[model samples]
Target: MGIQINGKGLLIVLSGPSGAGKGTVCSALRQQAPELVYSVSATTRPPREGEVEGISYFFKTRKEFRRMIDQGELLEWARYVDNYYGTPRRFVEERLNEGKDVLLEIEVQGAKQVKECFPEAVFIFLLPPSMDELHARIKGRGTESEQVMTDRMQAAREELNQIHSYDYVVVNDEVARACHHIRSILVAEHHRRDRIFKEQPDWLEGI
Candidate 1:
């Protein structure tokens, strides 16, 4: 009789500078690969129009979020503009243990913390074709003031310094091409000899 090969899961973390089209690429990746689980983060920020609980965010009060931090219930967390946002440990672990790959799209601060907590996780950094392009993308939004845009451009430069921490980098010159690169990375990762052996130790048992 053949032994059953255990199929484990992966935690795929995607991050980039603010104007690097992280959301665009992630949304496309999800549409192409619906089987991947999208990780929902816990945040103290209130829901906006049409945002749903457990979908947009796991909305929590400041007290609740503080308790989670104190109890080590969060895998990673950060305070942004005076609001708490974090990845809950239990939520991610439960899905991972069930052989479902979880896709987490996070900011630089939160992504840095997650790298420390889960070294085995796949970390992908998305980048614009050039700094000028990134600045243009931010300016194109027109929702922010010139000063705000300048600040974001500066921050993006700082965040780019952390690209060395990621396993792969995809330049977002085109959304389709970027998505293809990311998808290829995910597929190739599953075929790595070490990963194959680790996730399915008994694949050849009794053969």
Candidate 2:
């Protein structure tokens, strides 16, 4: 029989440039691994149509969000488009303690902050096939002005330069392929030497 990893849960944080298909891959991954608990972020922005609180996001007011940050209640936070977005620390830690692997989808800036709090967490960078393809994908959305698209491309370029900081880089050429790679990473990490061999097994004591 194969030995199983112990009860400790993993922290999986996924980040990448805009239009790199992070959301699409994550959606497929959640479907593939429904046991992976999702870490809902807290945002000061008003909930959009059909978005539910707690599940979609823990909607908070700007004052309350800043208070959470000041009180050291958030794992990572960032101001984007004049709104504050942050990860709640207590919920994630509680889930982890309960042996639930938590998944976090964060922006590049906020992700950098998460690294400070969870250096051992699995940080995966999703890269697009090419800059041209990335730009084309962003444009295809048809939701942004030309200037906004240019700004997003520039930000994406800056984010790409920091891929070296991540533990693994998954090129999102195809959604299915990308999800496969990410799942493989999760499985492999669980069997890593440090994770699986934290203490000597009694079976090998006399060998």
Q: Among these predicted structures, which one has the highest TM-score? A: 1
After superposition, candidate 1 runs with Cα above 4 Å error:
1-6, 202-207
- TM-scores for all candidates? 0.91, 0.89
Clashes of each: 0, 0
Residues 1-207, candidate 2: write the lDDT tens digits.
Answer: 345575568899999999999889889988989999989999999999999998999999988998999999998988889998889999899998887889999877878888998887899999999999999999999999999999999999899889888999999998999999998998888878777655335524545
Candidate 1 global TM-score: 0.91
Instruction: Tell me the tens digit of each residue's lDDT in model 1 across 1-207.
Output: 343333567889999999999999889988988988899999999999999999889999999999999999998999989999999989999998898889999987788888888988999999999999998899899898989998998899899898899999999999999989988988887767787777667777766
lDDT (Cα) of model 1: 0.89
Task: Give candidate 2 misplaced runs (Cα > 4 Å).
Answer: 1-4, 199-207
Residue-level error in angstroms, candidate 2, position 179: 0.3
RMSD of each: 2.1, 2.4
What residue pairs clash in candidate 2, if any at all? none
lDDT of 2: 0.89
